[model samples]
Target: MFELHLRQKSTAFQIEKRCKALAKVIKARRAPPWPCVPTPELPAKVVSDALIECYLRTNETLLRVLHIPSFRRDYEAVWSPDSNPDPTFLVLLKLVLAIGATTYDESFSLRPSAVRWVYEAHTWLSAPDFKHRLGIPSLQANILLLIARQATGVGEDLVWASVGSTLRIAMYMGLHRDPAGLGPSTTTPMVAEMRRRLWNTILEIALESSLNSGGAPLISLDHFDTEPPGNFDDDQLTGAEGEVLVPKPDGTFSQTTTAIALRSMFPQRLAIVKYLNDLSSRGSYAETLKLDTELRAAYKTLTRTLQTCKTPTNGPSDLELRAVDLLLRHYFVALHLPFFAPALKETEFAFSRRVVVESALRLWRAAFPVPLSQLPTIDDPLARVAISGSGYFRTIAVQASIVIAVELTSLMREEESLGLGPVEVRPDLLTALDDFKVWSWKGMETGETNTKGYLVACLVWAQVDAMRKGMVEEEWVMEVVKAAEEAETRCLGLLEEIEARGRQPQDAPFGTATQGVGGDAVVTPDFGVGDWDYMMSDVLFNTAGDPLSWVFQ
Candidate 1:
């Protein structure tokens, strides 16, 4: 009966009239017959086709059917167990590494099975004989990619041991050509955290290697080291032939027999001279003269060191840069000390101004070879001096302006005390102030919206200093108020632009600042004293203080 049914269904007229009848009979047979033609025996082609089908199929049952154990079993039979572990590991590791590199937004989800597969692969890599069993180069390369991902802030402690091993393997690879390669990944929070734990491991290896090879210290100096020096110095001096003078038991000078002993003892004698001078400086002219002499000596030493030192080829050594920085800072502090402050008056401020100019010029030249326009602007003048190539000239100019502003205010205050009254404001002072204003304004215009607040702060400081010195004339006061008003308006505009660009959903936290501006409606910043508060405080204090009280008394 089944054969008759099949024969009837096979008839061309019956097939055309009812194709469903043949399908039903074929379904009833449970499986295809010998004459029904067997599937092709190209295992590779079959596995490839099955994988493709598995990838394409969306239905749950179709995916399950395509993912049947038989396909993987066949694949394992052909390529597994006997193939070189290196190529196999690399091929699989590349796929695993791709998970982090590719973007996966809200829609995509990693399967638990996929995660398990990655964990297993990592476990295999950690095995003791992995280096020998698998080709080390390919394995090392893949391991580096894995370490990079972890260092780029991808994974946690769960895989950190693997990361350490990978880093060690990379070190073994003699890969010092790219120190900056690790920098980017090390900056990420995940990687940064991992690095904190594993840093000792890296440090141990680096230190050992560095010691053996006579390499530079791990914490060698950079340009930031070249900031202005602070308030102390201990001196060491030697005689012409590198001989040292020593002190006798009775405090008289004596020549030492051994060159090494003389070298060590000469510094102690110099310290005695410094200690005695510190005690003798009892707020008198001689004391001031002594300080001035010491400072001149120190300045000469610092400048000679800076001029004679070789510029680094790769980057400035941190110690060298810091030494320069300390020298500059000390020079400034020395100029400001009560004893040296009068030096400015004697030189008509020329000496002090020249010192500042020379220091700035030297810093600019030493740290950067590029044109000023290419340098980046930063907050610190000393930093600019260290890294002169980053559009830092404008920042230097701004710093110069600030120094001049403070000096002008001080001069105006002193003149008023001398009954010269508030001296008419100079065009130069006004020009410096205006340049600073424009610098800030340009920042805002260029979409550096965050800079507006900082500029406003600087302006407030200038204004406060002027007011405190009683140098703020009525016209100058009015100019400051107008500038503050303009700044406020600009800040409001920038806030609007920030909100517009954000275009966040109504429910999102960042977009909540989009509502309203000015007078009770605007949101106050969480921190910082605002521009208006500073200006108002200055006005209120100046108004409250009795200007005529001293004269009347």
Candidate 2:
């Protein structure tokens, strides 16, 4: 079902040319680093305050690594003309600003500075004596740095390693245990609760990082005794040495509410991640179904406020809800992936296939709310950056597109083999693939994974287009060749567009680049044909013998 043999030499050449050009753009975008100042300076008070506010709205609820009232005091002090904040606290602040900058403006105008802050934080953390300096602020800094990396797509490949290291450092600090068990030294109620919050945040990051990298979760349910944090507002916690802390009920939508809710299900979430990623623990279909049942039940138990975004005035922001929804849906996709291919050929596994498609469709909608055809010719720069700047969202979109493609192709093959006439492809699947092709452009600079995803979406989209034209299976290759030519044109156009935008005058109020738009040097020229041919082959055909295998994995 996956084999492709280009019958026409001209068709083969067209496919090769377009793919090579697209590959060239991918390489060019990766050529230059953003220009950096000799001494990185913080933005003005107003801008810095805006960044922190943005961070609080977007990230704090999810991470729950800080006691906001305490952090705010340090935040104000750093900006005070008479005070010099500790170097560690400054690093933490910069990482927070970097994360905020991604969502601060629609055009991602602060992205260059965001990248610089992450670099500076990395430099500080890499110091030989940094381990000796690890504290609550350092933990906050490291976690924020991980988040900032995901937002900016810098050091993305190393996130799994970085998260693992952070988890170990956290364990070293004894955060893996409940502070209540640590006796008089941990008697400060506010300090004890913050420790729990930070531990939960670290474990959650470790699990997610493991899922993203397809590795074993660094820590398991058995590894930690830290309790879920209270669903209390940061202001409710007094730093007085003997003050006792009390948590509000689950129905109350405080800042730590989402974190607490997620923490409540951490054990089940960890189980899902570990079972899916650990080869030795691979289980039967029945076991997978059982896990699925538990997951669904847990999801249903999530508070109504978290389950819906209808009342944003008293609950989590629409952004946070969408993010949480996508994450929960992703677990469904991951769980059923191993059986997705089998379900196409067997009746017993049909539920797996259905679950995969349903989850993917929901994810696509959450990631790109508008239909592809309805998207404006000149896209909204803010919406574009918000979606593209997030590595998590981009990954979801690409994965969803792959599932849509697989389902679309399977339907075509069934119709052809059964001589049942052309089957109408689902409209949502068609729109999703189209949107995914465009979305893939924003990620070209991040490198090979996205470029490969773009190619798959392009090829599958071509096949769907051909099917609509009543073309038989044998003629699909030629259509792919045609589509490849268009894709090359589109790729070049998008690259030119990016360069043009980079050259535009700065208008964002928060920050501006002091150097050229494309960074210190111009983008590199197109790579040779042979290099691209190798990339295509490496990506599309692996040892598994299935072209779609990598996408599923």
Off by over 4 Å in 2: 1-40, 303-313, 372-386, 418-422, 442-450, 496-553
Against the hidden reference, what TM-scores do the models get? 0.29, 0.82
RMSD of candidate 2 to true structure, Å? 12.0
After the best TM-score superposition of candidate 1, give how far the Cα of residue 308 lies from its true spot, in angstroms: 4.1
Best by lDDT: 2
How accurate locally is residue 353 in candidate 1, as Cα lDDT from 0 to 100? 55
Q: What is the lDDT of residue 288 in candidate 1?
A: 38
TM-score (C-alpha) between model 2 and the true structure: 0.82
lDDT of 1 by residue, 349-386 (tens): 45555555344434333333233334454333223322
Model 1 weakest 10-residue run by lDDT: 58-67
Q: For residues 1-553, what per-residue lDDT tens digits would candidate 2 score against the true structure? A: 2334444343434554555665555445433343421132577767788878878876786878777877787677655555534556666778888887776754565666777787777766765564333456667778898988888878776788889888887776677878777675533677677778888888878888887789888676777777888778888787664567788765767888888777777777888888988878856899899999999888888746475533546877666676677778888998898899999999999999999999999988876677645765424322343354655655666678789888988887777677666667778787887887766654553223233555566877888888766787668777786666566556555555555555677464524423221113221111011111111122111223333321221
